[model samples]
Target chain A: MKNIRMKVARTEMDLSQEELAKQVGVSRQTIGLIELGKYNPSLNLCIAICKTLSKTLDDLFWED
Target chain B: MKSFFQRNKVKDERITNLQNKIYREIFLIVAAICVLSLIIKQLNHGYSEANIWTEAVILLVSSFYYMIRSTGLGIFSAEVELHNQASKRSMAFKNIVFGLLFGIGIGTFFGIRSAVLYADSTLQSIYYFLLVSLVSFIIYIPFLIVVVGITYLAAKKRSDRAVEKELEDDQDQDEHK
Candidate 1:
């Protein structure tokens, strides 16, 4: 499964990868890897990231 | 399986490397001491001191026993750096204990020989006491230093781990809040 692209959500919130990862309890490298499709964040991490970005999981993580 | 520990491969490798280094150092020291003892015997008494070779042989055999016992744990056991901090500490403690034993054994051997040859128990007793103290201190003091150093570093590592765990816990609580 793929998460919906986070670039748009992050841009909407004006948050950097560092800011998002800190808010999501993950390293910045985790954020970078997620964005680059190198790693898939867990469902919990996805939810956390979405919450921090003020986006619903459906908005940020649902690919279809 | 991706356990919490599995995430830190670098840390694991570093720990293994440390254990292997310690093992190698211990092996070298034991080997060197045995060789030195043989050299001393050869120099002082010629090849007639074949029994010193026997002592060297025993040292080699015991070293083998230790290696075999340790190796069953893993490859890193073949060297010093691979041992866990606790294992290293225990080894240090064991070394100090054994060093004292060796000192006493040597002193007693010499003391008994002197008493038998000279029939002077008082002189032999004094000689044994002095030799035992000297040998024991010589063997144990350096190892005591190493034990102290290793203990300090191990404590530091443990504290660092505790701090990291606390940070992780705080982050978890904050995320929940």
Candidate 2:
């Protein structure tokens, strides 16, 4: 499923996909794919994104 | 924006290096085959063959060219980095597995055919079958390795180009925004 939490947080922070991708050291397409649920980001990448967004893994990746 | 361009430039260089390596390697391999053919012809005293001198000259020239061309390339001079390593690795692994399976099928088919069609006795048939299988395996595995290796390099180049294009597009979009 799409990471709705990531979308919500990114929009909240007003960070574009490219900006987040750059901060996470991945291609924008990778970030887009992850957001769209077309690709699964690795655990390292998840952590990177969490760190960049100043959120915990449980907040962004974990589903209730 | 600037980082995207820089990353793509580095990736493009790596891909170009890989592409050149693939071409050089394949050229050398083909040249080697030609040389081997020439040597076998020479050993057999040009018997049952048409014009050994012509073949030898062609092979010699081509082999020299490939050797020189391959030497000109700076392969593995530095550690190569690939952005799409995971997908490329997965593709290469799949190609090798499929190539091996296909090779086995071909080897088995030829072994069975030779054993059944050309043998004088049951014992001779079994020996021929095993021999054929072993020889075919030896030949097929390397052949598949070369084929798959070239394919992997070509796929890598394509993906790298795609990434560059994507980065350029993203830059343009950002500038407009």
Candidate 3:
């Protein structure tokens, strides 16, 4: 499933996918893929994304 | 100094993963092509040392490079750890089976080459093939098993130490926090 939570968190932080990806030290395409659920980010990458968006892992990645 | 390729490279996990996958696929394809070409040459011209040396060198050099790099990086140990967790069969047993298959392949290749070169008749060819194959198998099997086993054990030891160190470092950080 698409990571709607992460997308929302990024947007709430006033970040585009490119901006979030740059902050996380990944490519814009990778950020897009992650949001689309086409690629699973490694834990380190997930942590970095969470930090960039000011979100906890549970807030951005955990499924209810 | 960074090379042109390195200078322009993107520092992305997905890109790294894609590059690794591409490298593996290309290596396999190249190796397969080389093997097929060698077989075709052998069929048409019979076994000649000249026909095989280039392909053998290419395959051996690439394999050795990959093995050395992976071993140095503890990838082999990580793979063994993953394998142990995911599979019922032990890595050592898998290694032994691999060694056996490799030994048989090499033995057969040498046997066929020698038979083609030195045997005078059909009966003599068959005799030489079996004799050489058995000898080669006997020589390679034990050597491969021992060498591979030692390498696996040493890599595992290194990986275990690295993991322990990481755990200790994490604990130290937790205490500081």
Candidate 4:
């Protein structure tokens, strides 16, 4: 259930969880939780994360 | 320009969640210590109303401080709304239930204390406990219901207004942009 795709995208962008969280106006722990599949973010937050990572929701959040 | 308090305020949801969790734990620890101390005092020197005053004051002050802060931050109303929505319960009903439970807890505590202190025989103690508990419950239930219900309504109104203002501000910013 971990968001491996999102983690990959973030690493590819050379962004740490803290840096990505700052960009999304959230805490590092929130980003970590999302990646760890421990938290389900609001659509607004999801959109914000997608925008920051330059990825679509399907690319990062969709379960195949 | 950000005020000193505003500048240092934490805006992150996760941090706020963690802080609330920690605060609850700390409050529980303090409450346990106060109860332990009260028990120790009662055992050593018998039941004096003065012995309870310190613990009562500490508990009341902490509760009031938390309520004020949560209300100011709109967290109290939001939490109440969330709980009511999730449980599919009306706010008034929930408040009444809360009042009743609170009354029962206080009544039980006072009943036990009075029974222990004033009753000479076991039968008398049982009689005293029931009488005192019933009286305390009757006195506190209505008072708490009215007070808590009014406070919740007022806080919810304030929170709604704040949310509206924030939406208007956002709309204004979008228009300006």
Candidate 5:
């Protein structure tokens, strides 16, 4: 789980890491790590993030 | 946030001080029990009959001291601390209750087996009591260690979860504007 995809998503949505963290129910540090590909969110947290972004888990979280 | 951190630090320090005091008191009581037992043994010239009354007195005193000492530590005042302590108390209580139940069940089964399979005698009855008491205390040691370990881990995990949840909730509420 690298941050490349999270960074891409954030850039596409024009949302800051802090803004995304609020929408998805996580700490800003958590969002930073997600963008930096450091911390892996739990399944529930991943779903919450996907829902907040109007995306699918596979679309936002799945790795190539 | 700064005051919250400071308050938690103060709570940690106060709890630590109280815990140390409790430990010191327990240690002193144990030492006193050992000393009293030694004095009794020496005064009896090392060749006296078993003094059941004296032993019972010692047991009662020690048990009462332990109970009072534990109670005096007082309840955790902070909500977070209370939650952590409650989980610990419940886990420890469960471990003690379950361990004692299991030990008694096993001891009774063995005692019954020995009595039925062999000669049923007064000596055997005494032997059964001794064996069961020794085995039960030994069995309790591992359970005590495990219960303490699990309680510590659970409290730490819960506290971490609470802080994380608080941070998350604060952010969520901020965003609702």
Candidate 6:
């Protein structure tokens, strides 16, 4: 349940969920959960994902 | 940046390692069951038959099980980062629930044991069972309160420390830039 910001950023970066999960060392399911809004990643994880995708935390994770 | 990510990734690995420690998990479950069995056996077989070694094993196993289980569960319960406010609150709630549930279980076991050992008839045993259970619940309430309070406070403090560290890291990164 990825937020729109995250999904859009990852897609724009040409990174699949699996690739992002691999970069961050989390399972695919965890990424999926985060995407689906079923789970929230920790600060470290959020930072990792943002780094891998070349996005800021606000760009990928900020909620309206 | 590499070092920062590596450090945090180490934290993640530590958690994943514990989650994957199946042998320890099995040992913990088995030891807990053994402790319960020992208590039950003592009630049924009488305290005179309770060997000191049995008590020793129960204590040792219980301490290990509790230490590992609580830490592991706390770390692995949610994937949220350790410093997050929600993570802290969630851990606090989890600790409280675990403590209360453990108290209830111990109380029920001891209550039933008391009833079984003292009562001569089945009906009397059943009545004693209920009475003792209620008494056990009452006895455990104060202890549960203390335990839950301490756990929540400790978790909150740790969360604060983690957040402080995160902020410090951010500052360091800004300085580097």
Model 5 quality (TM-score): 0.28
| Tens-place lDDT digits, model 1, residues A1-64 | 3233686687567777556765665654456556655566667788888788887878876666
lDDT at B141, model 6: 58
Give the alpha-carbon lDDT of every model: 0.59, 0.68, 0.75, 0.77, 0.59, 0.66
Q: All candidates' TM-scores?
A: 0.28, 0.39, 0.55, 0.54, 0.28, 0.45
User: In model 2 chain B, where is the ten-residue run with the lowest total lDDT?
Assistant: B73-82
Off by over 4 Å in 2: A1-64, B1-89, B171-177
lDDT of 3 by residue, B1-177 (tens): 887676654578777889999999999999998899899998999879998998999898998787666665545555665566567999988987887788889999889988999999999999999999999999987888787778667766765555344333221121121
Would you list the rank order by lDDT, best first? Answer: 4, 3, 2, 6, 5, 1
Instruction: Give model 1's DockQ, 2 decimals.
Output: 0.03
| Off by more than 4 A, model 3 | A1-56, A59-64, B1-16, B108-130, B154-168, B172-177
Q: What residue pairs are clashing in model 5?
A: none
lDDT of 2 by residue, B65-127 (tens): 543443233111101122333255555567678888878887887899889889999999999
Q: Residue A45 in candidate 6 has what lDDT? A: 94
Question: What DockQ would candidate 2 receive versus the native complex?
Answer: 0.05
Put down candidate 2 lDDT per residue, A20-64, tens digits, no spaces. 766776666677667767666778899999988889999999988
Which pairs of residues clash in candidate 4, taking residues 3 or more apart in a chain or in different chains? none
Error of 6 at A63 (Å): 32
Please give the lDDT score at residue A14 for candidate 2: 77
Candidate 5 lDDT over residue span B19-59, tens digit each: 99999898678668766876777577653445445655666
Question: Considering only the true interface residues, what is the Cα RMSD of candidate 5 after superposition?
Answer: 10.5
Question: Candidate 3, which CAPRI tier?
Answer: incorrect
Q: After superposition, which runs of candidate 1 have C-alpha atoms over 4 Å from their true positions?
A: A1-4, B1-177
Interface root-mean-square deviation, each candidate: 13.9, 7.3, 14.9, 13.0, 10.5, 12.6
Between 2 and 3, whose lDDT is larger? 3
Q: Considering summed lDDT, which 10 consecutive residues are worst modelled in model 3 chain B?
A: B168-177
Candidate 2, which CAPRI tier? incorrect
